[model samples]
Target: MKKVCKGLGTVLVLLVAIVVIRASGSAQLDAPKAPAPLSVQPSESAERLGKAISFRTISHQDLSQVDTGQLTGFHQFLRESFPLTYAKLTVEMVSEYGLVYRWQGSDATRSPILLIAHMDVVPVDPGTEKAWTHPPFAGEVADGFVWGRGTLDFKQGVMGIHEATEALLAEGFVPKRTVYIGLGFDEEVGGVLGAKRIAAHFAALGLKFDFVLDEGLAVTKGMMPGIDSPVALIGIAEKGYLSVELLVEQDGGHSSMPEKETAVGILAGAISRLETTQMAAAIDGPAREFFDTIAPYMPFGQRLALRNLWLLEKPLTWKLTQKPATNALIRTTTAPTMLEGSVKENVLASRARAVVNFRIRPGDTVQSVLEHVHAVVDDARVKVNPGEGAADPSPMSPSDCWQFDLIEQTIREIYPDAVVAPSLMLGMSDARHYAPVSEHLYRFAPMMFTDQDRGRVHGINERIATGEYAKVPHFYAQLIRNSSLD
Candidate 1:
């Protein structure tokens, strides 16, 4: 009994020590430092972006569906809008449509900094055309918003980069390090023919980049519950993609008298099992790194859980999985996108097929995803085959480097209220193609987006606030000048 009492006392003391240490750490997060103010006129910036959105450079999965004329017209529009940029930088076309621009710097030894954005946007859903407040292709500027498909998903980046260059050139600002900008045409459909070819061109020339920046996460507002201000997420790594075809074959017979378990039934059961037994959820990897960066600003209770991660990992993961957005950050997500079985209502089809798509997380591979699917299904009757697109997880870039610090500093200068953190990009981007040429690749768009605005991307009534759209050019200009000037 005495020993038991002693052990209890020791445990109490340990708990008290943990509380004290966590309280000490919380003090460091109490005050968030704001960067210097960014100054710019919003109306003038929105005019150029609105005009850029007028050209419907939509990229379809079927290359034949894309009208190449629209792409050419868009290129012409850019040249006419930014004459100063055309005068300063040398621009060339790759793969007939993709654009690459070079701005020579004073120093020849330093590797160039690459800025990339896609010119193409996803097509509006065919039947849902009438649902938009402003037509998807209209480039309408009304109600303090620039409404269009590409306004958010990426036309902002394309126009913003050019605007920044034109502004800098007008002021006679030249970079000390070479700068390269790549505007890809088919990023919406995997960028294979666009960014892939341009990356090859750079690789063939034996060119290396000091760092690469591409469109990704933005300054998101109201994402974290306990934290009020915006969180600026910078993607240091991107998840991979894989699609698998699950086919089941069985003997066909009349619908009036059929076997107890048909092909359709078997496939349905397998899919259900796979969904129920998902890959384990975790709070480690880049997700953990994200929480560590923002933990200091969170409320006391939230900070306690993040600070004492070792004791609360399971609970934290459970909390994260409750939200769809946060859930994808920690685990490889699986969704059964397509399924086909019977041709007629009265027929018992001999073969049934289903397509399951997976966004593979870092530390997980294409092979591992297949292995898990097979193990969970556990049926020799069903055969699994690789589908069209399959890519292994990408390598993680360094978070602690001169390039990252420069990005952080630039963000502070533009958005003083944002809390910056490194994140794992759950969606696909053209940045993946440039991984081989650059050791440090960071993905961020430097724009403000609310949760509703996030839903608008690839959805109806897509738009960007005129005021927010204007800040993008300023952000890029600061990033370029700060990183290269000295």
Candidate 2:
């Protein structure tokens, strides 16, 4: 009896200490103040963004299907619109449409900074073309918004960078650190041909950047549960991509007389089993760091739970898995996008195939995921093979570095109401290709996005508010100025 009482007392004391320590940490946390605002002309900036979107620079997975003329026209449009940028910055075309502009600064000893964005946009689904309020490539300014495909996904960064650089050049503001602006044309399908080559070019010259900034999560509103303020997620790492084809073959027969199991039935069962047995969820790595940073500002209950993640990891992970967005952060997500079997309803399938795509989480590997699939299906007949473009997750960038601080400070200056946090990008970007060039690659786009706006990305009615569209140029301008200063 005495020993049990003593153990209970010790447990109680430890719990109390955990809460007390978490409380102290929360008490010390205060929101950072917003920096002074920089001004931008809404009409001029919006107009330029609109014109940039007018060009249909869509990337097709099959290069032969892509219209090279559209890519060339877009390049010509950029040269005509930003003549000041063309006159001042040394622009070189990488591959065919990849644009790399070098703005030589006063200091040569310091490694340059790279600003990344893509010139290409995903091809609009032909079926959904009529569903858009404005034609996908019309680039019309309507209802106080710039409506176009790349208005949010990227073209915002592409034109925004030029707009900022041109304004700075006109004002005679020269950077103390050299700056390179890289715009890849094949980022939509995969940057293998475009950004990959650009990074190699820099590598051959023994070039290293202080940091590389690419289009990623933006100033998001209403995403986090407890925090009332908007959150700006600077992507420090991106999930790797893997696509595997599951194939099954069986004896063919007529529909009237079928065997006990057919190829389609076996493949479908395997897919079902794979989906039912998901990858183990973990509340660690970048996802945990994100919650840790935001815990202090969350509601009291959420703050307490998050602050005690060591004790409540299981429950928190379960809660995160309840939502798709949060779920992706916690584990490698399995999505079976395409499946094929019989060509006709009357015929039984002799062979079946399905493509299962995975966005690999940090601390997990492509091989591990494949192993998990094989283990889950547990069928000898199913043949599993890795599809093309399988890649492991990119290495995590340092959050404590000056590059991150600069990005956070710039975001605070532009959107003071936002709570900035380091994030793991679920989608692949051109930044992955630049990973070899810099250890400190940060992914952020300086636009304010809401849940509704986020859905518009690669979806119908994609648009950006005139005011929101205006702020992007000023944000890039300030970011360049502050980071370039000696």
Candidate 3:
């Protein structure tokens, strides 16, 4: 009994010592004190953003649903709105709607930089329009918000970049390396015509970039649980996308005599299995680095757990998975998005169908996800097939590069109080298509958002605060100026 007690005590002391050492070794990363933010007329930017939003350049999965008139109007509006940019830079349209603006640099040796955003947004749901305080397409600036469809996910990026460039041109500022802005018109669906072609154009020219920055992570508040300060998340990598259809076909008859298990029941069971047995979670790649960087800012308990993740990965994963946002960072998620069981209420389903969408995380493949589905479902009654638009995750960008350092320094320079951390982008972006051209591709939007505002992006009442909207232009201008110094 004494020996057992001694052994337990020794283990406890060892654990405590290790935790203390890890915590002590961890240092909180901070941005150096920066100058007061440049005065960009935010109110004017807000008004301009409203006018930009009035155009309904919406992305529809079916090409027939697109309105070409709206695109032309929006294109013309940009030219008229930013006169200095039009005069100073060479603008070209790739694949009809893809907008590319080139500001040629003086030096031949320096590489170029590509700034990206999508000009298109997802169409609002049919019945959800009435729920908005302001109409979705009216582009109303009311109650401090520029309310509209693309405000958050994200025409803010589109207009904001233009707003910055126009302001920079006004000052007669020129870059040492060329600056290219690529705007995709169909990013909300896929960027085949827009970003893909823009990428090809750049490739054809054999023009390599220092980095590519697009819309993804943001300066979000109160989203992460442990950290108190607003975190400026820079997306160094993004999750892959895959959709699988679960089809169950069997004999169908009247509802009078039903079998023990119907076609719909089998399909439901498969979905349930997929949900319950999700792909395994791990803290590696961008996700792992994200936690490591943020650990010093966390509370002692959280800090201790994170710093010693090598010893406590399982329990820590359980804790992180409790929340949906953090959970997504570490795992390939399974969401059953669509269902088609029966046409009529009284009739049995002859063929039942379900579509499960997965945002594949790092360290997992499309094949592995399919294998997991087959293993968990384990039913011959169901047939699994891949849906359209399956994509593997983009290659992870290195955070150690001068490109990342510049973005981090810029974020810190603008918002000295906020903590800057590299993150894995959970959503898909047009930035992914640029990998063939640039090795350093990052996705970050310079807007601060709360938890509620987070849901508004693709949901109803999507908006951006007019006051905060000015920072978008200010940050971009600074980044452009900083990037210019060769």
Candidate 4:
């Protein structure tokens, strides 16, 4: 009996020891993974793309003129235009206008990839149609490009991607992994009903992607003064936003005999302090990674300056943050957007309120920003409240992996003369919604834009160059072809 009892005790101790070793092994295995490589081509069918651009599918803030009927026509147009894509791929609809298509691959073990673009364009201004050299919805093929609103903002992406898929299908080229195309209907107006609902659809199906590509940055010339080549900026992340309202209440009295500190006076003082004591600018996150990638492409002297960013980052950030455009890249920015006070012109009493909008940097939070505002406007009478406009900054994506390198190499193959660089997007996009689950989220619209073309994005005379328009579809095709599951 004694011998049996001793044997049982030894076996129990061994089992516990094995369990501890297995737990430790699992913890260590969860290290960060490197991004995958992408394979891309540069040739596209431009003639077909021009025809696809002719459709007049526009999105408006007012739901009345949205024209769901036009959207249906546009969908039909896609089917008739790209017969190969419609026949081969599986399509799903998230809502009335939102579309998602999946191109299956040979291997199912590898995670799927998503390419996203919105199909809707903002409504033309009340009388800006005449300002356009070609009508906003004309989709004319003049001056070697397509002239239209959606041509620049997004229709280009939609048409280009579909055209690429169609061409690839013709060549019988198959992807090693599954590729998904997610199209939103209302991106210009926050994409709440469109992209937000689409995200929920993916979540319900337990579909997690390796990466998602969307529109944000583009290739630009003279972006960097010394660099001669056009730089292709791939957005790794975007800033957060919030609107804070400061209010001060005072007893009603005659304007002729007001108190020493009137309600308006108190509000003005708070605004001044908040503007003067802006958030501290820091060099970190995706913004710093952006400079690091382009450093090698820069002149030796400039490269030296960028390579030693750790030491020079603080001073460089402080100086850049002083300018309006450069300032947006470094820290949270504040702008006094709206102000409200008394009801009548003669009355100068009661309550005064001012609305300040803020675009927050990556590391900061809404709570931390609010605390800073309170500290800056150190007045007992002034009360700060969260305004309607507020959104936390999107999470930053990693750039060190093969996913970013693939984007750089693909752009190089097509526009051999252009330089590729990472960037921090100043504005928000539907891309933000996918960042939480995706390892790599890139924002790039593979189209060429000149100085004048840049202004047309949300302004008048929007159009894309003819030669460049033809290459847009080819860029998408190359990106899809270059990507492999291995």
Candidate 5:
């Protein structure tokens, strides 16, 4: 009887092992498959895009330096370049720099789609002209590249969308749903006058869009290792900006005679403490979704690492959020940007202040971040204050919805080799303004760029490949046609 009982126990253990093995195998099999490749048709009207890049509508940090006449020239260039688009669409100027064009569709009951891009480019630093392969604003076409400043940062979107719309109009194709194109003039300085005004205009008109697509992410090769395809990041949300000032005050005296802890010393110590006790990192929101979507494309080790994210989230977050680029992905980051103290070298007088800039992550509030800093510094002598009109992190859009799936499908059609992944944009854009009103707001510029091309954006020798110039517009056209209200 004892031997029979032992035999039954061994059989039960083997059965349990088999069940676990099958469950593991099933989970592996359920992993997502790589999306289908994108098929692109090269644009015949690529020359017009080269001409569009010639305008020098650069936005300066100092508003007074902006050349209004140059912007006017750009407006004229748009009018002359795409005659079909101008003739077919109804264009309206919102503010001095904001341009919005509305194309009437066959079905008005279906929700409209808004395509956004900025017309302005950031000012090139003084005395960097020598580095360019061609002149920055010369808009030279050489070696199958369109060399200019706005070629990548934006104007590519401007021209690409226009070119696509024009091409569709030429082909006598009418969209099933209403299509709106918004071009902001002051994106570099902040879209307050441009995109903000446009959003206000739409709000006042009681207009709501189904989805709005703007410039944010791009398709990149080798961005995700172990994934053979290029990772095309789609910005589902953006980080918030907050400038915190830490002020410390103490008794002043001559340099020869100083207190044990001076104002400057106290401020520096507080800054150091805050830096060492950095914000806690935990993967959540769009960033977590991003990794999950691409996990199947990764190697077996990386797949396992990503699959168990929920279980291993604490350690993974700590490891990934230490670096600037990766940290920007998970939690809010604080950087001590500016310092102010006594004017004279010899006089160690009263007060010292440090301005620390924070890029707040989603799910993080300005109040919460400030509280964390206060706890870390633990200095009663120091006072922490908020900066000018700091915006909180924008709300995240849904990844499981059809809106995102449509975007991923469009990208796959445009760049078949690229894998669509969600990402959190560290910098701000006009897309943030629309988040409150629109259900689905995405940030992505469908232009193919290599590492060198990416660097050129807002840098010296900015340029876009001619091949990309042609492909991007077609991608926009495809997206417009493919997207349905349902």
Candidate 6:
């Protein structure tokens, strides 16, 4: 009995020693930087962003609600706002409102770099206009922020690209490789009319870019667990979103004389099953890369778990699942967004419909999700069909490449103390549409976000700080210079 106790204690100490040794070997993530921030006058740029927000280029689910006049006028606004950019770059409109500009570089041998952003913004909720500190479309630049709908959902990205190009043009600095800017007008509604068409247009012309950058992740603070410094998340890939509608049809009867299973009850059961039995979560591909990249910055205990995921994957995964944000990094998320059954409360719901949205992890597909749904629900009464915006997850971009290094270096230039890491984008972006155009697709916007600030996107009081707005142009200019000069 004494020998058994001694053997167990010896094994435990050896395990602890192994964890310590592995964690101690982790190299600190300190990227060297020598570049400085590029120029964008904060107040002036904030005012410019505010004015752009006032255009009312909102995307609606109903096509008739979209005002073409406002979109056309936005093109004119860009013409007036940046005179030098208009004069220097060759501008071509694709799919009516999608604008494509090409800045001719000295060496056409080098493949061009593409920077993209959407011009359209999601509309404010019906009654929430009065709730805003400033009116949603007022384009108010006050209180250290440019307050409006597009401030965060991304008119800033559109303006940032132009501001950088105009500055570079003014300084007589020419790109060694051709630079292309794509401004899609309908990104808020799945980017079908905008980025998809523009990407096809690029393909038809046999233009394969070196890399394409779009807005997704940002410089986030207090978002990462067990890390103190601000981390710049560069999205190497994005999750595909799928919407599946569950339908049930049953015989109608009086509320007092209900059938054993009404349509509403059937749909409710299907939804419950989906919510409870989520897609299997595993650390693979981009998620693995994310954990590995940020492992060095974690506290010793967390560092041990991260560095030794081979032995501790299940326990660490369980720990990560405790947080909603971290749980999303590992699996396909199921969300029941819409449901319709009966108009009156006392009436039996003979026919019911519900929509379940899934943000697919890299290894899963639309077909696979449907299969899982059918297998799990295992009910003949529930009808399942694909809904809007079904797409497969994008292929992972190479993390160890010159394009990635340039992005890291440029991030360090502006955010010297920040840790740069490759991350998976939880939300869909227009960047995914350009996958056919470039294998090297990255999604990152150079704005700072905190835990309290993330809800502002497509939510009330949407705004970006004047100081943060200034960094966007500098980040782009530096990225352009670094990529082009290579």
Candidate 2: list runs displaced more than 4 Å. Answer: 23-40
Worst 10 residues of 6 by lDDT: 29-38
lDDT of 6 by residue, 1-486 (tens): 999999999999999888788888545656665654555577877888899999999987666889988999889989998999999899999998899999998997899999999999988899988889999888998888899998988999999998898888888888999999999988888888899999999999999999999999999988887788899999999998899989998887779989877899889999999989989888887889888988888888888889998889999888877778878988988999999999898899888999899999999988899899999888999999898679989888988998888888889888877888998999888998998899999999999999777889999999999889898999999888887664
lDDT of 2: 0.88
TM-score of 1: 0.96
Task: Tell me the RMSD of model 3 versus the true structure.
Answer: 1.8
On residues 281-332, what C-alpha lDDT tens digit does candidate 3 reach at each position? 8899999989988888888888888898888999999887988888999999
- Per-candidate TM equals 0.96, 0.96, 0.96, 0.84, 0.88, 0.96
Alpha-carbon lDDT of model 6: 0.89
Lowest lDDT 10-mer window, candidate 5? 22-31
Worst 10 residues of 1 by lDDT: 27-36
Clashes of each: 0, 0, 0, 8, 2, 0
Candidate 3: worst 10 consecutive residues by lDDT? 30-39
lDDT score, residue 243, model 6?
A: 92
Local lDDT at 143 for model 1: 97
lDDT of 1 at 390: 95
lDDT-wise, the better of 2 and 3 is 3
lDDT for each candidate structure: 0.87, 0.88, 0.89, 0.78, 0.81, 0.89
Task: Give one digit per residue, the lDDT tens place, for model 2 in 1-486.
Answer: 999999999999999888767845443324555543444467877888888888888888888888889889989988998898999999999887788899998988888999999988987877999899999888899899999999998999898898888888888888999999998988988898789999988888888999999998788888788778889999999999999999999877789998888899899999999888999999878887788888888878888788887788899889989999999998999999999988899899888999999999999999999999999989999999899988999899989878899999888878877788998999999898988889998889998888888779999989999888888887898898888755
Alpha carbon lDDT of residue 174, candidate 5? 85
Off by over 4 Å in 3: 1-8, 25-39
Candidate 5 local lDDT, 1-486, one digit each (tens): 999999999999986555444324212222243432233244445556566667778887566788888888889889987899899899988988789999998987888889999989887788988888888888778888788788888988998898788878878878889999999998887788889889989988888888999999888776566776678899999888889999988888798898888999999999999888888776888778887877767776666667676556777777787676777888788899999998899889598999999889898888888889889989799999888858888888877788888888888877776778888888889898776558888999887656666578789888877777777876788888777434
